[model samples]
Structures are given as C-alpha cells and as structure tokens.
Target chain A: MSTGNWLDARAGGARLSRRGVLVGGGLLVGGGLLLAGCGGRERPSIESRDVGSDRDRNKRRLREILDRQTEAVKNKDEKAYLADLDSSNSDLVEHERMVFANLRQFEFAEFGYNTRRVAAHGDYTFGPVFRITQLTADESPVGAAPAETFRYRLAPKDGRLVIAEITPASPGDQKDALLSGPPADEAWNMTPLRVVQAADNVWLVGDDSVPDLEKFAAAAAAEAAIVRRLWEGRARFPGDVMYLTRDDDNYRRWFSLGKSSNFLPEISGFQTSRTGVRQNGQVYSDQRAGAAILINLKNIRDYYSGEDPRVTMHHELAHSVTAQLRATPSIISDLGSPTWAVEGFATWATGVRWPSEASRYRSQLRNGLGSFKGLPSSKDFYGAKRSLNYLLGWSVFAYIAQIKGREAAVEFYAQVIPLNDTLEPFVELPIFDGICERTLGTSAGAFLEGWQRFVRRGAGA
Target chain B: MLMVAAIVGLLGALVAGVGAYLPTNRYQATATTVPCRRVVCIPVLKASAVIDALKAKGHPCEQERDHHWKCELMVGTLTFETTIEEVEGLISDVSVLVVRPPDEEPTEAVMDYLLWLAALPYTADEALTEEINDWVVDRIEADEDAEAEIGGYNYYVVTSNPGSIRLRVIGALR
Candidate 1:
C-alpha cells in the first residue's frame, strides 16, 4: 500500500507525551512554591522529604544532564555530549559517541528532553524520557514532529548520576498507573549500528554490514532528490533517517510490530510516524516530533537486485514527506485517510517519476475495469486482491491529476485523508462524495465515470 | 558411485513407503461425504436435526424471519451470532459473526460446528482438531481472509478489527 507492501509503522509515543505533560505540570506547581519562598514570603518548607523528594531530586539531576547535553548538541561539542554517559561501560560510551555523531548530521530546529516517570531498578535508576527533535524548515517542512521516548538508565558512578544506557522506549515504559507496561525490543537500539550520511537527504543506518552502506546511501540520495522534485512544493523533505538491516530477526523485530510472522516480503520499505498528542480539541495535528524510513533488507533483497528499489524508495519517501499531513493524533490507529488515497498518492508519485509505470497502470486499469467495484474499500486494500486494488487506486489519482489538475488532486487528497476509522462501520461514502464534489467539481459517481473513461482512453480500450 | 546411488535409491524408497502410512492427509475424503470417526460415514444433518443439536448444546436458538434461524453461541470468550438460512426444510447456508479479541484462542466447538456444516471428516483427537482450527484462525488473522476447498466443501473466512473473525460457509465448492 505504501511503497512495496506499504505498512505504516505504529507509534505508541502519545502515552509518553501525556505523561510528560503531567510531570511538567507538577514541576511547574513545585517551582511556583520555591519562587514564592525566594521572594522573602513566610511559608512552610515546600522541599519534598519522601519518595516524592527522591523522585524530584532524580528529576532535577536528570534535567541538568539533559540541559548540558542539549547545549552540547547546539555547540556541536561531541566531547561534552559523550561526557554525561557512564564511562565505566566502554560500549555505552562508544555507542553514545556514535549517537552524537549520528545526531550531529541533522540541522534541528528544536531539540530537548522531557523527563517523565522514573523508578529505581536494583542499584540503578531508570525511566522513560521523551527526546523531542524537530528539523529546520529548510529540512523538515512539518515543524513539530512526533517525540520519541527512550528509556534512559542512570546509575550512581563517582558519587553522581551518569547515563548508563539509552534503550528504545515502549508503551510499557510509560506505566505510572493502570496503563503502564514494559520497555520495547527495537532493532536500532539492540544492535551496533553503521551510520552513513547522504548529504542533507538521508542517514542510511544498518547493522554490522557497512561495505555496501555507501552505495545504498547514494541511491537513497538520488531517490530523495527524485521525491523532492515530484512532491516539491506539496510535501515536506526533511532529511529522513533510513534503517537497512541484514538480520532477518532484526528486520522482523523492527517491522513485525507484534505479529507472529517475521517474513513480510510484501513490505519493501515503510515510513513510521512518531505521532504526537492532539492538542486544543483538534482531530488532526501535523505536529509530529520525528519520522523514520525503514527498508526491509532481508525481504527487499530481490527488489535491490531488480529495479523495484527505485520504485519503492520513491514511494516510501513520498510517505515520509507527507507523514505529518496524515497524522491523526486522536486515533491510536491512523484511520482518517482511505487506504486507496494513501497508497494511490504514493503510487501516482512513483508513476510520475517512471513513465513506463503510467502505461503499466493503464494496462492494469483496462484489464480490471470490468470487475472494478467502485473504489477499493479498506478491505480490498489489505485483502488478497491488494495488488489489483493498488493499481486501481493509482488510476484514481492519475485520473484526478490529469483531468481536474495536479494541484486539485493534491488538495482532494489532503482534505479527504485524516481521522475517520474506515476499519469500523463508519459511513465514509457520503464523506467521499461531498469531498469529491467540492474539490473536483463533480459528484462521486461522475468522478468515477470520468476516471473510468480516462483509464479506457489511456489504455486505448 | 553406482553402488552409492543404488543405496540412496533404496533409502528413498524406504522413506516413501514409511510416509504412505503416516496419516499426513489427516482428513479422509470419500466419494460424497467423509466417514465419521473411523468408519460408517455420517449423513449430512437435516435443518431440524442441526437446530436440535444446537439447542442440546445449550446455544440459544430462535426463529428469525421466514425459514431463518439465529443462534447465540460462545466461542472462546467471544459470543458469535450464527444465522442459518433454510430452503425447503434443508439447511442451504450458514453465516457467523464472531467479534473476538486479538488474543482470543480458537475454540474446538466452533471448529466442530464448521466441520459439521461442511460435512467434512473430523480428526481423531478433539485437541488435534482445535490445533488445525488454530492454524486456520492464524492464517485468517494474518491475511484477513482465507479460502480453501477441502473434502467437497468450500471454506471462506474474513476477519476485521484484527480480532472479530466472521465465517461464511457456502454448501459446496462445485
């Protein structure tokens, strides 16, 4: 649906954001009392002396380390950035150094850490920390991306708290009440990484296998240029971070989410949105803290040998650029957009780059026209007939772009895509009709007829 | 090399002969209906007998509109509403709407009902039958839909909510 077998990577970081807000509010209230006391007002001691005190102390100490690290990043001081990590563990220190190097490649507009829930573990203290990073407008068009929460482990070394290990944060790490669970097992955090930077376009990250990493980075750079040209003014072109894994277990670990099956070759490459919290009663918020592109190297090995990688990279990059526009923070599962529009837009963009694909889609449409069931439903998109549905969907966008105009097609997509869960028994047909009439100056039926004719003409049927 | 090749051929024949008696097919198919248990093929139940079986199993069966009956049966922790269509005093088709949770286990009783509906041969052990049902459920859960023609019957399945699996069984594949 996305690029190859396009599946959107699930981001459960909203739970982390809500926790950050609560903790931030408490800190503000606590700070108010201390500030009042500083003004020479007669008040009882507001200093905590219980478990809250210990938590408060830890929070303050962690904040100081985070502050120094943030400032170091601003100054491009790699030494200062690595100084806060636990030096006793050389692996941890080395990893942080690599992390610093990786992070330094990006031109961030906003970057900081929000200290969330903290707890004691054996002799060390660990908790979930939300690392908020937003690339500059020149880089990422979407200003505020989704915040990635990581488990920052701290231990008392040399009579002070130093960073022990920073692990991939999971929904379980946000647990303070009835909701909280455990940490995640992410491939990126689990293995030693090989980071390759491709100008301002991509950071190709793989594991252990670095010989052909530069080649992939170069290809990614070329694809990124092609995506920028295709999307140009319509979408964001933030320097995307791409993960390429050789290990089947790592690929499965990264892409499988929680499914039992590990091998999914249908998934060529995918873009995961780190979805942010919806604020001000809004149904959709383009504000995501970050997004990343993951290429299933194990499954997509055949695609690499073929020319499918060019098509897949372009398609996934299209997703990465338009990631925030499709963000539906209110819904845990992104349901606002129809699978057809989402997949169709990306597929259409791919066709724009390769003219041969246009003829291919035309041929598919001509063959499938007899059994065409209006637009492909959500069922059709993920069903056994997914490939046909994908081509059929691509035809919709191709028609709109050709007949109504490309700008109109983009507008129609933007308006129709967002928040309504098509998976449920939600009536989306009327909504589609309304949007179609308003955007394309035709009823849904008329648009379908026009699309059918356009397909027939293109196919010379 | 000739002697080694001869020995390999002999071993392959031995393995194939052993495999013939392994019962790998599981469900045995006869001309029209698969035999029940070990022998003596069970006839396909009439609509009245099927209704009686459902009632005896403690499932709530009620007559809906003309010749249609709806039954409430618990499969795992999820309740399934099974709607039966009868044409001329015979069960024509059956459809089930099961809204299950993501982690819900496949139930043997439900699989048994499906087997009965299809008139397919049942596996010897109930647990083994449930295991086969689990495999089917896993396939449906992963792919969202699965279709298979087995023992003169067509099995069609579609799932939603990554949990609620709805099953529809037509009379036969042909």
Candidate 2:
C-alpha cells in the first residue's frame, strides 16, 4: 500500500480505539500502568469517621462535585454548569464561560462525560479532570455510530467545579498517550469540525480547527452551496470524501505542492493527499467509494487572515467535483486537463476574476503581450502573468456557455479530457470552428480574432 | 597622662596617613587589553554613533589596539597610529599601533598594500596568512572571469564574497 493509504489505515484504527475509550471510561494513568483495584473497590461506610477523616471527606467532596459537573455537561445545561463556579475566582469563571461557549457551538443529540482527578486544599478545591462528551447526529442510521469525545477540562471555582479549557489535543499527544496505555481509539487528537452529507453518495468532511468554529462552518457551508448550485444536474461520484485538518503539520505534509512533489492536481485541498484518476470518460471508484481532501487549519487561517480563503477552498473543490462527474468504469484516467483549463476554470468558478494584485496583472499582461507571441507555459501560469490563462479560458468557456447554453458548456468541459487523451489541442481551430458553426453559426478564425480584439480592448493594450 | 597624650598623637597621625594615600587619576586613565573575537574587532573600529559624532567624519581614530593579545583571526595585516587626544574625542579607553608590511616597499606599493589589507581579514599575528592567500587567489580568478570582456588589466578588482567579508570583519576586531 502507498504511504497515504497506510497513514489513513492507522488514523482510522486510532479513531475507532478512541471511540472505545470514550464509551468504556477506561482509566489511563501514568505509562500503561493501570490502577489495579479501581473497579473492584467497594464504597466505604458513610458513618466511618475519625481524626484522619478530613482527607476522606475531601475525596468525597471531589467525587460529588465531579458527578454534578458531569451531569450538567451531559444535559447540555450551560447555566447549571456556570452556576457551580466560584464567583471569587475570575479566572475560573472566565475559563468556564469559554468552555461552555465552545461546546454550545456544535449541534449534537447525545454526550458522554468522564472525570479523572479532583484535589482539595482546606476550603478550596481544584479538579484537573477530563470530560469526554459524544456528539451524535439526530438522523443517524440504525447502529450508525455517533462521532464522540469532544474533550474538556473542569476546574474548582467558588467552592464548586466549573468547566475550563476546551481545546482538543494534537494527534501526536494522542499517540504518546496511547503508548503510555490510553486506549487506541481515542479521538482526542484526530477529528476535524465540519462534515457535510453532499447528496446521497458524496460526503464532504472538513476536519479543521479555527479560533472561530462558527465562522469556519459558515464559510465551508457557503462554499458547498456554490458547488451545489454549479453542478445541479451533473453526475455525482460515490463515497467522495474531503478531510480538512486545522493542524500545521497536516497542511505542510499533505498540501504543500511545491515541497512534496506529489503534484496530483485533481485531489487538491489545503492539505496534501494522494492523486485521483478518471477512467474512459468516467469517474473511478475505490473500496471506500470516495477520495479524501485534507486542509491544514493553520494555513487556511494564515491565508484567510491575509486574503479571502473562500476562493482557495472553491479551487480545490472544483477539481474534486469536476473529476467526480466524469469518472469511468475500468481503465484508470490520468489527470488529462491542461493546467490552464483546470486552474482557470476553478479560478473563474471561485470568482477570482483576475490573478494576483489587479494593477500588477494588467501591466504584466500588457507587457507580455507586446513582447511575446503565444500563450505562456503551464509553469508560468501562476507566476508574474498567471492571470492570462484564467482570462483566456474563462472568456472561451463563457463564450461557449453563453451561445450554446449550460449543458453544452458542461459537455465541452467533459470533452476536453478525451481530446487531451489523443494528444490533441483542447480546442483545435477546426474543432472550435465546427463547435461554433453548430452552436452559433460562426467561423473559428473570426471568433479568435474577436477574442484577441476583446482582450486587447479590455487590457487597453 | 603622658601615655594618653601619646595615644592621641598616634591616632591623629594614622588618620592623616590614610587620607594621603587616596587613588590617583594616573592609575584610572591606564587601559588594559582584553582578548576578543575577530568578528567583534572591526565593528569596534567602525565606532558607535555616540563616538562618531564626537570625532569629526573621515577622521580615523585608534581608540583601542591589542598587539600582545591572543586572537583566533591571524590573516591580513592591520595597523593604526594615532594620538590619545584624537582617539579620546572619538572613543573611551584608547590604544594605538603603527602597522607596517613584513618588509619595506615603494611608496605607491605601500598605499595599495594598505588599501588591500584594509579590505582583507586580519588577526594579531601571521597565523591565518595561508588561508588569506588562498581566498585572495580565488577572489582574483572570479574577478577576472566576471570582468573578462573589460580587457586584460594588471590591477585586480575585488568583489566581496559574503563568507569572506564576514570573516574579514570579524578578524579586524580581533
């Protein structure tokens, strides 16, 4: 198996084991050193008290506090959880507020809770404990699993326990914990946030974290809405999945195209993954019935902070969606689309009308046209004059779609692959001429001249 | 009573003797040389903003020098000769050295040698001369190739390589 498949298998196995631990409440303390008599010990008599009974009372108090706090979280009672906080400690109060706010951001049908530790000093008590809560979808299939374990920390406040710190641990941390004896399937470090059910067959999973999960979800949903609108009547690929990771390592390892050299443009996302293939003018299927797209959360944040990340998402999604609508039965199809058309179409679909800084694009195109004779190479597509390809392809596709209608445009987009397979130009002058003659009753050369003239006028060259 | 009078006289003399032995400026003005890294030596000569303003522009001052000090840099030759007054205006804690080639040369050759040595790496002694010679050869060859179209010339133009420049700067300080 390839490296990517191996990693996926490991990640899947880990996710399953994490799920088991959340349900089982298996204690993993120290390094795989399970406490022997944990489940076997019986409760001591309530009336048994002496001079050393303060320690016992404190332990009892910690257990009581934990039980109440866990119940409050399981019931999704934001007010009850906050009510347990000590008003004297502002830090504890703030932490509780943040944790509850994080939990409330997600929609879930059920939750699970576990408390690990509780310590007391005189009148004051601090419980540094783990609370694992499961998130179940409302319309889950029979025996369909609930995505579980959104972890939280509960600390003592106002003589009571309050939820504090709700950030998920990293996968590396989970791996360390597992090596030291925590169950294998703990999702503490794995799961990304947004998972979408696209039609009946396709599932778009965005596993990324943001300082603002709500905003991320909204942005993701907006991008998905655009895809649904654009490919309304097209064929859908089955079990086509997209995975987004908010972690930096995930983005650098998976998505960094220049560094990794995996250059599989069709299976593009913010994070890196293996390539995708189409077969004989159709989309191909694997055992999982889908493909995975991983996006680094940190990179997304960086790009979004500087520029609109919506376009980046749309660009990757366009490749995945387009490939899905054009897969075959048996023979594997290489990514036959030209760099110009593939990137150009996505650029257009994402509404990035121009490449780079607008002023720079205009001046560079004007200079390049004045000195050069033909189109720039694929390598130079996104360089200084990267926008030229997008401008040309969009104009051509728009022109065809306008006169020939949307169906014809879709058909033309699909045909470019087969045309490419024969080592032919995407639209040879003769073929373009024939399409124009059939669709709009125009000659190919006249149309080409018109396009040149229009572009020159647009650029004021 | 005689014993008491003698004790008082002795105490008075002791106090006067202690007052007479106070620290003097002659010792305070004396400067000591400390061994420093070659990289640190050049920037010291460049003089900080506070020192540069005190000494008028274009006036080279030898604020400090270490002839006997041990140093790691021992390449190109560096020399300086200046009065304490001139350097004191530009810097504090000053010393000076009069630099000369290993052997005497014609006046024109001396001027060229001084300029070339200033641009090269320097340390206290002749320890790094071999390394400096190798660097000089490589530099001359590179210069010739770069300026080949400019026609042949006896005088070589020096282009700064970053590594060599850093080393030279460090060596000057030492």
Candidate 3:
C-alpha cells in the first residue's frame, strides 16, 4: 500500500465513494494529489476557553453533571446516578438504572468521566465522552484500567444537562482524541446488557436476545466444571464470564472484530479479552482486564435445542483457564506461542468424551500425513488446512500425554506457555524445541518425529 | 478556406457516428422514466438497464429466478457472486456473497466496491450515490447494520452474516 493508501485506510476512506475516487482521480490528473479519504471526519474546532461564553458555561455544566454521575457510580448512589440521566426518556433512565446496578458488581480502584470533545446536535449536546475505570481483583487481577469511550447525547432537561442517549464511540472518536489503537465495542457499551450470575463464579453477560438465561447459565456452569477437570492440577481454572446472544445483530456486532472486518461466519465460539485503556508505550492496555467466552448462539442450533454444548463449551473454557498463565503484558504485536500449541492444548482439553474427534483426526491424518508441515502456526488456524492443522495440534499434546504421562504434558505446557513479554525476534521451532528438551527430556526434532510416528501409529498408516 | 471547411465536415461526420452508438434519449426515458411496451414493463426493466449495468461492468449475468439475475463480478480485486432482485421493475435488493480463499479477510477495496454497488441503483447519479455509499459504510462501521433515508430512498446495509452482505434500497414509490 502507498503512503496515501495507508492514510486512506486509517481515515476509513477504504469504504468506497465513487465521488471520492473521481475527486482523487481528478487531483492526480491535475498533478496535485490530496489524501483526504472519504468518511474522514474533520476534527471539530476547539471551544473558546472563555468562562463567560454560553457554550463554555453549558460545557462546564455538562462537565459538572458528568462529574456528579461518575461520583454517584463510585459512591454507589443510585438516586444521584439516575438524576443525571433525562427523566423523560424512560428507556435511557431504565438503562442507566441497569448500568448503575451492573457497576456495583465491580470493585473499582478509580472511576471518573472526562469530556474530550462536545458538540451541539439539534436539541442535544453530543460528543465523545470517556469513562475511566480501573477494576480491582474482583474483575481483573492485573489492576487493568480501561477508559471506555462513548458518544453521549445530552440535552437540557429543566435547568441542567442530562444524558439523553449513550452509544459506543467509533474509531473516529479515538482519532479525534489523537489516541492510538483501534476502538473496541464492548456489550455494555453497544447495547443494554443483562449481567446474571450463572454459577458461583461463572457470570453470564449477554443482551436481551439471550433466551432462557437460567438454562444457558446452568449449561455453562456444567461446561465450566468439565473445563476445570480438564485442567485439573495442570493450570489454575479462572472463574470468568460467558457471553451468548441470540440476536443476530448483537452476535455479529460485539467485540473488536465486529462489522465483518475479519469475522468468519463458521465460528461457533471463541475466547476474547476486553483490554484496559491504551496509555504510554502500549497499544492498548498493558494488561487485559476482563476476559469473556463469547458463544455464537446464532450458529449453534443445538444450544437452543438443549443439546449438550460440552465440546465447544469445554474448548472455550479451557482458554479462560489458561488465559492468565499465557498473558504477556506491555506489548503491541500478538507474539507468543504458535497457534498449534495454544489451540492444540484447548482441543486436547476437550477430553476423551468425544472419541469421534480423535477418529476424525486419524482419518484426516491417514490422508494428509504425506504432506504434513512441521507444526501449525498462528496464521495456519485460519488457513485452508485448518482442520488438519487443528488435529495435528491435538496430536502433539496427546502424544506427549501418551508417552510421558498427562502430568508431563501439563508440565511442558506450563514451561512453554508462561508470560514472557520479549520484543526480541526469534524463531518458534527452536523455542518449542528448547521447551520440549527442558520439560519433556526430548529434543524439538525428536518430539516432531515422535509426534508424527504416534499419529501414524494411531492412524494405522 | 476550402481545406478548413473539409476538416470541419469530417469532424462533424465523426461526431455523428459516435452519437449514433450512444444511448438515445428515448431509450433513456423509456428505461428510467416511462414504462415500455406493457403497463408494468417488468421485462423491459430486466432486459435493459439492470442487465446492461451488469454487462457494462463486465459481469456475465443470467436469469436464475423469475426476476432475479445472478452475476459474477469483481468487487475490488475479489470476485463475488451477486444476486440482484428486481421487484416491480425496480432493483429492490442486491446480495453479494464474497468468494475468497480460506483465511483471507475481506479487503477494504472489496467492501467499498460492495457498498458502491448497493448504493448505485437507488442513487440518482454516480456522484450522489458515492456520497450516500460513503455515509452508509461509515454508519454501519460505526454501528451495526446501518439504515438511512437519503434523497428520498431508504438504503440499508446488512452484515448479519459476514460471508454474505445484503443491501436493500427501498424507494419512496415502494
């Protein structure tokens, strides 16, 4: 991509506008090129700092209202919190009530609201508003502080500015703030969330579309136990949240990859971490605070039918169990273990209940072992041979467990998958080899040879 | 003077020849404004503008359903199969199912192309349609599936399934 093209991507000009293309073409033909991409919102002019100005006075009032609301949240004062929201809009008031109730569940070290930019939209003052929060160990063990940014539309109800509406702030909002990193939409910010305690530790956070919350939660709890058993004495089982949405829009629109940038339809479930606010040298949060398992209810028809969601559920829960163990702090690039190990372990943790998976793997192995790659990497997870790669990944851990005992396999995982936030470039093969030699008393080359042999033997090749 | 007169006459002849190949005013009016042949003119709508648009864009279109034309076209560098549904002589909906290599993500150019195509039929002109396209894409990007009323036309971009995107533009007449 050219510098102009890169800028266009950043400016969201990649969303085609023929007029923009024509203009750009005209400019190029005229020998004066400009990189003003389509859909690029110009920064609103800074407001005058003059205290006497009506705009300034109103902004100050809005600031006070925001401050009061933030204090109410921190203080756990429901009345005060509800006071800041417009009373006429029963929906906003009701939503804010639920929001307040949700906020009480978390232990916040710091909580406040800061106004970055404000503009008058019709009868409402709309701007990008940010809610700064740092959760204590109750929510995040790492003391993750994230500034949730939202577009707040406030209007003067009676004599004060009250919040009329709240929507997730777009990437453009961050652009306006001159902030780095892509904006992510959390369920709380996107829609009215229903936070329910599924089990003693398992919290079910979903939207209204989630059907029979209690039933789903019970199933999720059962799966959580299976996940714990899978990682028994191997890794700590982190009691976390599970998200499910029957509403197709919510299912597709939540989290960072929403709006189909990299979203694949075939995905049934995945683990995602909601990170803290980006600051200093970090791309976003140095540590991820909130980790949740998002289940695609739209794809899984069996879930609605009350069929056992054990296989997929266990796979996702295993991820949460190993999340903290694998978290690498203070990094921009997603560099760590190869996908073979990460997903391989998860698939392996699916346990022996599903012998069909192993048989399937063996069948695939019998066919494709002729052209087996050394190991599947992170990129291979989405590749054409992903199924083969997934099975191969499972085969690695399964081989280790078979040869050296399950304890040895777990030990190998612990040694290989710990948090090592190194920026130095290194090949994964040697690292895996080194870890294998240290943990399993085998060379990386020997491991691969043995793994392939084991796979062939299992396949009767 | 005689040589200049000869040159002018030759230029006039060339202009006349080019004009002959261009779409006539009657064709444009009939295709867009007035119903041709029958009162409903559904066949004319399908045979002329909609098919012509696909053909002009180098897509091989065939009538798959009664009034539905399925065409293979290149949006950006990616080739996608599109089904355009004609309801009551108007292109009511267009669904683009992107065909990409496994593991490949949809490129911005492809997305832009899809949005532009969606906005094209309902828009009065290319320029205005482009503007609407930009807004619709941006709105959807900011929110979820976006719906907006622009220039008396209701434009919607649905991403319920990322693999296939459905674009529906309902005109005031509808």
lDDT per model vs. reference? 0.55, 0.36, 0.56
Q: Model 1 - which docking category?
A: incorrect
Q: For model 1 chain A, where is the 10-residue window of minimal lDDT?
A: A4-13
lDDT of 3 by residue, A1-461 (tens): 23232223323554444566556434433321122222232211112122234544555566677778878887889999888777999977887787787676654556765343234444355454556655432244453345666666667778777777777655555565323233536566556667677676777776777656666777778878766666676544246677777676776667754553336765777776555542211234545555667777767775435544557777888777676566453344465555666777888777544666656666776777666656655543557777777777778778888888877776776666664423442224467668888878988777778877787776332
The predicted structure with the larger lDDT, 1 or 2, is 1
The per-candidate TM-score of the B chain, in the order shown, comes to 0.54, 0.23, 0.53
Candidate 1, A1-461: lDDT as tens digits: 12111001101111113344344435544644544344432322212112224444554566678888999988889989988788989988887776676566556767765442233443345444545555552244443333455656677789888888777655444544211222233344456666777767567777775456777767788888877665557655466777776566666566334342223445777766554321110111445445677776655666556433567778888777776566453445544457777788888888877888777877876776666545676544667777777887788788888777777877787766654446653233687778888999888878878887766666332
For each candidate, C-alpha RMSD in Å?
A: 26.2, 31.3, 19.4
Q: What value does the lDDT take at residue A407 in candidate 1?
A: 73
Give native contacts recovered, as a fraction, per prediction. 0.00, 0.00, 0.06
DockQ of each: 0.01, 0.00, 0.03
Off by over 4 Å in 2: A1-211, A238-242, A255-308, A325-335, A352-387, A398-411, A418-424, A429-446, A459-461, B1-174
Q: Which candidate tops TM-score?
A: 1
Q: For residues A1-461, what per-residue lDDT tens digits would candidate 2 score against the true structure?
A: 13233222222222113343233222222211221223332211112113234433444444465566556766768777677555556866676665565455443343433222222334333322233332331222211122211233345655555544333322234333211111112212233345455433333444444443344445555665566567565643322344455555444443233343343333325322222111100111221122234545555555456534565666666665565333222233233345555555565566432344333544555555554333334444555555566555554545455456655555555544223222344345366567556555567676556556645654432
Q: Which window of 10 residues has the lowest lDDT sum in candidate 3 chain A?
A: A42-51
Model 2 TM-score (2 dp): 0.34
- Candidate 3's TM-score: 0.54
Give me the displacement of residue B31 in model 3, in angstroms.
79
Docking class of 2: incorrect
The candidate that achieves the highest DockQ relative to the unseen native structure:
3
Q: Is the docking of candidate 3 incorrect, acceptable, medium or high quality?
A: incorrect
